[model samples]
Target: MQVTKTALKRIVLNRLYDHLRTHYSVSLSRATFVNAEPEAHAVDAATAFRSDIEIEELQRALDRIDEGAYGTCIHCNAELPLEDIRKDPCKRICRGCEKFVF
Candidate 1:
């Protein structure tokens, strides 16, 4: 059976939880980056940046859902396929208008 939008939303919520956990993990503490070696600091910054992006994307997804625009391509207004949504509930653009993969 085809999955419903509510199910897709739940998937996004679950992923948001995972990203939040990673962003707040004890081992990835921001305080440790303050006195770490240059390489370690760089890694920490990169990790933090990635986590931030992930969290933002998930939040945007939730917003889009509330707007009744989830699974709709933001760039071209195309309807994103259910398969794509299943693959990534946070995706906001369709493949045709996609300029970057992340």
Candidate 2:
């Protein structure tokens, strides 16, 4: 079944909120591990860092949706295929941009 843009927006919002919650929990756990287990603390810190980045990206995606640019490439302004967006809501660049960057 093809997903409507509204549905895709909802999915992306849900995922963003979920990630925010996960990031908070990871941060709490990281704080606890700071003095108890150095290795675990480092791992949790890294996870929290990555989660923070993802949260930012998802927020930008939400903003793009509000601006009617959710499925458009940020670099080339190309319309991103729905399948690609479905696979990764945080994607902001088209395949062409990806190739150009690499």
Candidate 3:
């Protein structure tokens, strides 16, 4: 089962859309943002920014797929298991090397 670039792009876009929809709904809710203080709003903004960053990272992963680097563990250059890749589309390391990634 090959992971094509189109498949990866769809995954990234789906996640991005999910994230934005959730955030937008929260921001629109009267109870969540309307009553929040300045510090609380700042925290919410930071959280949203982090989620955006993760989505961007997934986009980079999709780009790597386009570059013919997907499924290869970045740490070991070994082909990552298809099962793991399917389970976590953003994975960059195999189970054995995952602990050492950070």
lDDT of 1 at 52: 66
For 1-102, candidate 3 gives per-residue lDDT tens digits of 466556555554444445555664433443343243323553246346455666566556656767788778878888887677656767888887977765
Candidate 1 regions exceeding 4 Å error are 1-3, 25-51, 99-102
Better of 2 and 3 by TM-score: 2
**How much lDDT does candidate 3 score?**
0.59
lDDT of residue 20 for candidate 2: 50
Ranking by TM-score: 2, 1, 3
**What's the CA error at residue 58 for candidate 2, in Å?**
1.1
Please identify model 3 stretches exceeding 4 Å from their true place. 25-51
Tens digits of lDDT, candidate 1, 1-102: 255556665666556545555656544443333233323443335345454677677657766776677888888888888778767878778998886643
| lDDT of all predictions | 0.62, 0.62, 0.59
TM-score of every prediction relative to native: 0.57, 0.59, 0.57
Candidate closer to the true structure by lDDT (higher is better), 2 or 3: 2
RMSD values, in order shown: 11.2, 10.7, 10.2
